[model samples]
Target: MRAALALLLLVAAGTAGAQMYKWKDAKGLTHYSDTPPPASARQAEVKNFNSAPGADLPALLAEVARSHPVVLYTAADCAACAEGRALLQARGIPYSEKTVSTADDHAVLKKAGSPGQLPLLLVGQNKQIGFETATWDGLLSSAGYPASSALPPGYRHPPVGSAAPRRPSAAERERQAQEAARAAAEEAARGKRPPPPANAPPDFQF
Candidate 1:
């Protein structure tokens, strides 16, 4: 009887150690379960039940955030953008900011269905082109964010980044420069002129 009890306890301990998997499908749907995600699932993450807490975010807030991530798009020298950011901060909504400052950034914004609009807010699939306190509040509430601040003390949102793809690191930039220099030297050796910039007008001489 003692040996049988010990075996049952071991089985229980093993069951308790099962990890959870969180992932997004090709359709952009998020899923969470103890079982492993499908091979096709993107951004899959295994969460250990016994892991120490990092951010200590509230359970409800974390759940809501996982289901409906928030993103805000802003531009420099825009008053509305500042106000929108302030509103989100006041509400303790964890969100990432995308700054639209370059042509590439603007192109990405347009692709996201914004016609070069500033202060755009995205809550899951919902889009708000402009900032309005009531509208923004409604969207957050609809997305299951708490009405009042639930963010932990000292918690800070992610830093703002450009809407364009991430810029290469310094090492990558140096490597590219060296490659360009080598190519230029090779072209000069062959008595050939390097191509002009892509944006150069057809009539513009190299």
Candidate 2:
């Protein structure tokens, strides 16, 4: 009976979605079964990863994305940023990146809740300042991302950073537009608009 039970457990371990318990008998023989071990035996749980709910994966990932959107703030020529980017790509995590290359970029990074740290990671409101692989992995796993990558082939992330996109609010947009128009009008009134150079397009207004 012991030999038969051990063989059965081995078979069960190969199958998807199989739940089994492992323990050693009084004789020190290892055994596994779908039922609980006897009180005298030591118990351990064995999980099968292959049978994890495939149908629910999409919904699970979507919920995580909604509740914890991943954002990475990086900069060019930074070794840490490069490593962090590679880690995210390897994990097939979908994330948005903000590159801090200019004054405007620095302002945007600050507004995103960092103390001007490069390679900062933001999961929803949770801030991780600096690139640490183990910490990043732990947080992402806790947030319910799959252990293996789920990205499809040929997936390309969009380009990073727009010169000061987050810094300009609607009011700022209107204010800047008004200022530009005022400057243009004043120049026109003073007839100070410089004449286009030779071969310049007629539509050119300086």
Best by TM-score: 1
Taking all chains together, the TM-score of candidate 1 against the true structure is: 0.59
Candidate 2 vs. true structure, TM-score: 0.51
RMSD of 2: 26.9
**lDDT (tens digit, per residue) of candidate 2 on 55-150:** 222556655754565678888899999999899889977666667878877876787777687888876557788889999998888877777787
Candidate 1 runs further than 4 Å off: 1-53, 169-206
- What residue pairs are clashing in model 2? none
* Candidate 1 RMSD to the correct structure: 21.2
Clash count list over all predictions: 0, 0
How does model 1 fare in lDDT? 0.73
